[model samples]
Target chain A: MAADRNAGTEPVVDMQNVSIRYGTDPEVLSDIRLSLEKGSFHFLTGKSGAGKTSLLSMMYLALKPSSGTVTVFGTNIGFASRDAMALMRRRIGVVFQDFRLLEHLSAYDNVAVPLKVRGMKESEIEKRVRELLRWVELESSMNKICSTLSGGEKQRVAIARAVINRPEILLADEPTGNVDDDIAQKLMKLFVEMNRLGTTVVIATHSQELINQYNYPRIHLENKSLKVFPALRRLSNAE
Target chain B: MQNKIKLNHVSELPLKKDQANLFLEAVTAVMVFLFSIALAGYMLVDSMAKNWQNGISGTLTVQIMPLPGDTDSQEKSLRLNKVITFFENQPAVESVILISETQKERLMSPWLGQDVDISALPLPELLDVHLKQGADFDYEKAAQALKEIAPFASIDNHNVWLHRLLDLASSIQTLALSVLWMVLAVGVFSIFYAVCTSLGIHGQIIEILHIMGAKDDYIARQYARRGFLIGLISGAIGTAAALSAFWWLHHSAVYLSAGLLGSLDISSGGWLLLLSLPLWAALLSTATSYWAVRRTLRKIM
Candidate 1:
């Protein structure tokens, strides 16, 4: 709630000369420097193995950057303790590329996990979980076990789970990959609505058509480096 | 302070939640209960052996020889009243019970044929001597005293047979104790194995809970709670079943052991001790859970 909603503030995410690698392997991300402001919508486009997942992992604090200073919400990530990282995680929601829904829980319980972890009372959890399930159009399938659900359903459930706690920042990796184009458009619209409500949204996708349709900034990954393109300029030039 | 919030996050049990864990908990309880009952039974056996040994520790028997004359008149007519008085007056002998001819003939009834007239047949006079608890009796001194009254009289100490019986009882008790120890060790190891499995399966869930700001104690509490429930159910079932089996065997042994069975009744205290099995099982399960969670959590963070 303390996050800036008005214009003219430091970016929510600021990375300078940051590089990430898996163990001692060659750098998967190189010299990445970027700034993402509050309430901004951005799409990350890259081919497979172009470090898109690795970069998103860094932003979500799943993996620490191998070099340079990476700050999330003006706090240096590398210096943060485990408790701090968990608190920071609460502020950010991530939709994994694999749609990592816990297989043993029902769809409703899976979505309710983040809320439960925050110690929300049962009644409040029920109300919020029901609302989020409806948002994902999964209200009818709330009691179904995740293992029995279809791929698109799983992706929606994962999205519902990530955003259920009303995170200030949401990062989605290939959220629409398993769904049809129509569903992909709907998910994109949901992200836009969240952005309008002051959530900083970053979506990693290879669908340029979906990216082009939205009037949002783009950060494209090519040869392990990130390139940003202005959203308003591109839209105006197209018109 | 911030750790409290994290604790709340990690406190939830892994995805399948309480029901599935209940099944495993019940299993653990049963095993521990069985283990406890076996231990109590062993204890009971040991107590019985001690009681028997105390009853027979320092008693001695003496067999008197028949007079060298007419065998028909050598029985009750040759009343050795002087020898009996002398033995009773001895300081080493606390009390002496003179065996009557009828009683001596009755004692030998099992080995000898029936219809033997006590007035016609010559039989040895048997003396039962009870020694004072702290008094040390020399066999040579007692024998010499008895021989001066009548030649051909021998004192039987009865130590050899008593020693063999005591040794047999002690060995049985030791065997039962060894068995009880083995079962307890197996129970502990079984719980350890189950805890290891739980850690392996729920490692990620534990990690997520950690990242959610859950403290080590919070997560461990969840696991311990599950284990406690399981141990309770399993321990109760196993203990009840074992008791039933023991009851059946005990009843059947009454006819087989020729009235010695009633003397070795499983005491109420023994039953009370056995009833603690479920509690022991619960404690064991929870302890195992706590140890596993702490060790695993440390490795993760």
Candidate 2:
């Protein structure tokens, strides 16, 4: 693994007085200030339509803040050119809740997209993609079209794609939502392993059970505002 | 486990066998066909105009008519010799040849009956006057000189009728070229519309690719490739159709009046240009699609 050129004292993601709104609609999120240090793990928890996806979108450089600044990897995203934004996005991996995979392509091809987008040679892409798919227990279904795959299979494929690049910042939206407990734990372990390797991990989920099992801070969204809760086990241990 | 994967089967954007693209290909084929035909027509007319100009310019025709009620052949022969001698003495005249009786009879047979005795009629004596290339000859002065030698003699410079024919050919060439340009414009617009529609159709997939760190060029390249293939295949079809039409026209032209229509033959260089239309079409389509995709993607995240 190569060292992240952006690794430094600056937080991996820094949001200041950020607000987001759709066209002609009220703000989905407002006046948010947050920062995540490098190599940190956090769970984003919110009710339906609480703008969890929007926050992830901003961090992933998909959506610009309606007001204020969103600085990802130490660069203010509002000022980034489209090409620059694309480069920044390459360092950040995202798993959408809907599992945005190219349905017409095979699972192998879906996992290979990030590497292919980076212009990696096909041989290296094949080795990396196959290894990741095997780790996700999708080797048997590697050649199956994504549209024909079950929801849990699609979820695993999406996770494989997100982690294939070993992104500097990994944002997973309900990554384990469709998987069973065993696979969900496996997926969580994968994220934990990535974090241990210096990848910042952010998981957006409604699964409080999974949250309770993991020793990470929680950013809870309610009424378009956010509150941070320290890890319960860590708080108890401190007490 | 299969050790080899055919990566060509994989596309980040699923754009294969799209119905909209099929329609676009059909439209492109039709446009290319029209463009090829118009281009070939323009080339043909241009070639004909050049040939006619080369054959007609710098030459004059002199016709000595029979004297009124003069049945004496000696008198007519004297007048003919006088006009021929006058042209032969001019410095600009390269050579003057009296039209053969057989050739005159053949020329008149087209208008008169084939068996009619041309000698019995008061047919004018014709002479072909060839002038030296680049010679500065005054047509009015030459005609005036010829009239003085024989009162009934007239010099046909062939410029007035030739100019009218050349003008008509030039207008047709311009019209054909204009049609070709219009076809190309329509081709570009059709490709643009197809690419824009594809972008809209694949909007979600495009956003997903973007979120996955794909650049505008990355996605635009896929469309460009598709556009290029469509243009190439469609252009080939259209060019083939146009070539067939030209073949039929060439075949049919052989039976028509050869003197008026000329050879109807396109030169080797003209053929090469005609054959290159498909490549130009492909390039045009590629540029149009690439531009359309990039322009549309600029509005996206």
Candidate 3:
């Protein structure tokens, strides 16, 4: 309920003229500006090396921008302390394309991680984790080791883990890149369901078919610049 | 029904159970074993040195040998009795026992043989003098007093051999302490290396946890706790092994040498120090892992 501030009231993520690079190499992202309103669903579409992951990294506070400010929840994290940044990251849940689930832990434990890190009580954590797993239709495989799950099942588990804390924002970097079309569609529905319940969702993908399949605003990355396609283009882009 | 499945508190806790931790624990155990040996050696030598000082520090021996060519048993007897009376008169002297001919033969039989004529060789008259406990007797004065009683008589306080034994004991103890220090250094470095390796192997799991809003301390604690637990268990085993070894070795030595080195048992303080090894090792391992985790995490974020 803390994030139930009116949709379009204040942006959840605001990146202002951000530029990022690793070491002495060329900037991966340059002069990139992006903003997403609360309770909105948006797709970050770009080619393989068009800096989509880099932009999402900035949004999650995993990478600092080189020469510009990145504000999350109305706070600039360009110079945030390590503790402050970690606290900020809890509000954002990320699902990597690789489904970075801990292979050693069972599905139930994998989803309980975000809550455990916050020192949640075990009873409360168990109830909440079971509930979230049930939402993803993974309650049957709750005890299965993450590595043993199918690609579709793993993606679902990742989603459940991301949204378990009811994060104000959810960022997925190509969540369906490794799954079949049937499974991808199901995963997309999970994201849409989360968005409908007031969680801002950002999915970065280069799959044009996925982009065209949905009617939502999109932020496209090209030549180090980010361009926004509002909801009207959803029909045009789909057609 | 599947709700009965075991769920860990944290998913990315560590590099999980692996041979890496087991190997590191073995290394730590070896270090603790070596340290315990060195400490036991140091304690045993120190205790022996103290005992030696106590025994020889308050005793003196006086000998009266006649001129080599002179055949004078009557003169020797008179001078020996005079020397005994001179010592018995001194307030510092607790008791002085004059050497009887039978005792002299018993001491000389090893070198001279049992059948040799005892009267054929000129042997010195000996006196054993014990000083009173807490007596501040002057050693040089006692020697001077004995020399005046008979020109051929001289006193030995056993200072030369005592000094040599004490010096050797101290050197051995110092070397043992140096070895203990080296073991500690190796223990710390090895623990640090093990923790860093675990962190590297579990890097992805750590990154996932980090992205999920896990603090650096929370991430570090996983490895730190494991490191501490391994070190503690191994250290305790190593300490126990060392103690048993020392006990067996001391008893074997006593058996082989016919009860020699019986004083090799570690004193109470030394036992306390040895028992503290596990705690010290655990603390060191925990601290090393904590720093390693913090440093590794900092490099990424």
Candidate 4:
């Protein structure tokens, strides 16, 4: 009930009266209403099993809510055709906590997957992937198998892969977990840069330090509902 | 150590143990082996039947048996000589040769043993007659003339019973071809299962691809390519094994002596046909994977 208003901007993500349940179980998320403005940065913070990942899943069009509708870029996620949903997903970038990289692929190959999916020319994909990996300091590990990489290195590779296509929306779930302070800071910097470049970014995490360290607005999920709060630091002119 | 794997842009040749199973490859090889053998057998049987048909239609067997009332050697020779003269005088008969007693005994040796003498036993004489190509000889008139010379003589026009041999060969050929079709179906189903298993193991990666905005066609094409390559390699190995078997069996008189596959020497053209099966196998596997993966992705995504 405490979700934010649309803020008079074109909404990139809009969820209205959404409630979800599996079979006869209790509703995990009940009557949640939220809208994400285009070109805005927001953080999602919640306790374990408070439906942080579930909300992100719905935003990416992977799951449909049981009762209500969720729309991405004005297309109803629950009602759109599969092909239409696929096109919508192409404009969104996702980074995961586990860094789901194919073990057989090298770092460069993993990042090139999206471009290859789009049917880009081999030379173009190769050049872009190389440039992105070089930016993430993974140029040395480009040819290394993903499974052999350290936790920090794998997450950086995941970040590079997510932003390769300059997606209009970006979602990261626990992007900074399982890494030291320096590595976490580096990953945060990458996300911050992606947001400044006009991508609507959403990050879901349990880290209070990140919330205290950054001035981004926060959406707190508790008891199957969401409440939005302005950041404690300097308020943005855009806000 | 990791082998160098060449990759193209559109294919997801996941060079990992989880993506491909050797069991699938082995099953494919066995199916292709069965298919190759069945096809080769059909060709061999069809060829033998044709040869026998040609030879039988162009020849006659005049069998002369002695009458019981006058069973003397003089009477037997008189009847045989007259029949030989009559056939020689006919314009349609190409050549006629009386099968000698020694040759008769040799023909019967398989049943009578090598040293057994059939001199005392009454045996009919056979006149092996060859007809000229395109000759229009009235076989009924020839039978009537032989009957007048000796009531016990009969003409065995091999063309009469040769139809039955052809029928048997045709039936066997049809059966072998049916078996080949069935084996191909089974091969396709096997590949379907293999591709499905690979997808099951890599569900997480598939979810990631879905997140990456890969369409259903793109994902399915990757599996199709994988299936095609696996089928080509496995089918080549299977065909090589089957051709080797054909060579070994062709040289062995014991196996080839029985049944419709008598004395087969595969032509170069036939060998070429056998070598091209890997391409067919690759295509079949590609189609099967395409259908199977589309179905699975529908259920998955």
**Pick by TM-score: which candidate is best?**
2
DockQ score for candidate 3: 0.69
What DockQ, on C-alphas, does every prediction get?
0.19, 0.59, 0.69, 0.42
lDDT of 3 by residue, B165-230 (tens): 899999998999899899988887887788777777777778788899999999888888887888
Give the Å shift of residue B39 in candidate 1: 0.8
Model 1 achieves a DockQ score of 0.19
lDDT of 1 by residue, A138-198 (tens): 8888878789999999999998888887777889998999988777878877877777788
Best candidate per DockQ, number? 3
lDDT for A61 in candidate 2 is 87
Q: How good is model 1 by TM-score?
A: 0.75
Pick by lDDT: 1 or 3, better one:
3
Q: Candidate 1's error at B217, in angstroms? A: 5.6
Model 3 stretches astray by more than 4 angstroms: A1-6, A177-186, A207-210, A233-239, B9-11, B14-19, B66-77, B97-126, B132-136, B255-262
Ranked candidates (TM-score, high to low): 2, 3, 4, 1
User: How would you encode candidate 2's per-residue C-alpha lDDT over A44-145 as one tens digit per residue?
Assistant: 999999999999989998899999898888799988899999888899888889999889888999998888888898879888998999899988898888
True contacts kept of 3: 0.77
Please write out the lDDT profile of model 2 over residues B93-153, one tens digit for every residue. Answer: 9999999888888777757857877877878889999999999989998788777767788
Write the residue-wise lDDT of candidate 4 on B73-125 in tens digits. 78788888888988888899999988988988877876787888888777788
lDDT of 3 by residue, A1-239 (tens): 11223256788888888898889999888987777788878888888899988888888888888988888988898667888888988999999888889887899999999998898999899889888787778888998988899988898888888988889899998888777777688778878877878889988987778877776778888887889887553234657
Candidate 1 residue lDDT tens string, B209-259: 553435566677777887777677787888888877777777776655442
Model 1, residue B208: C-alpha shift (Å): 6.0
DockQ class, candidate 3: medium
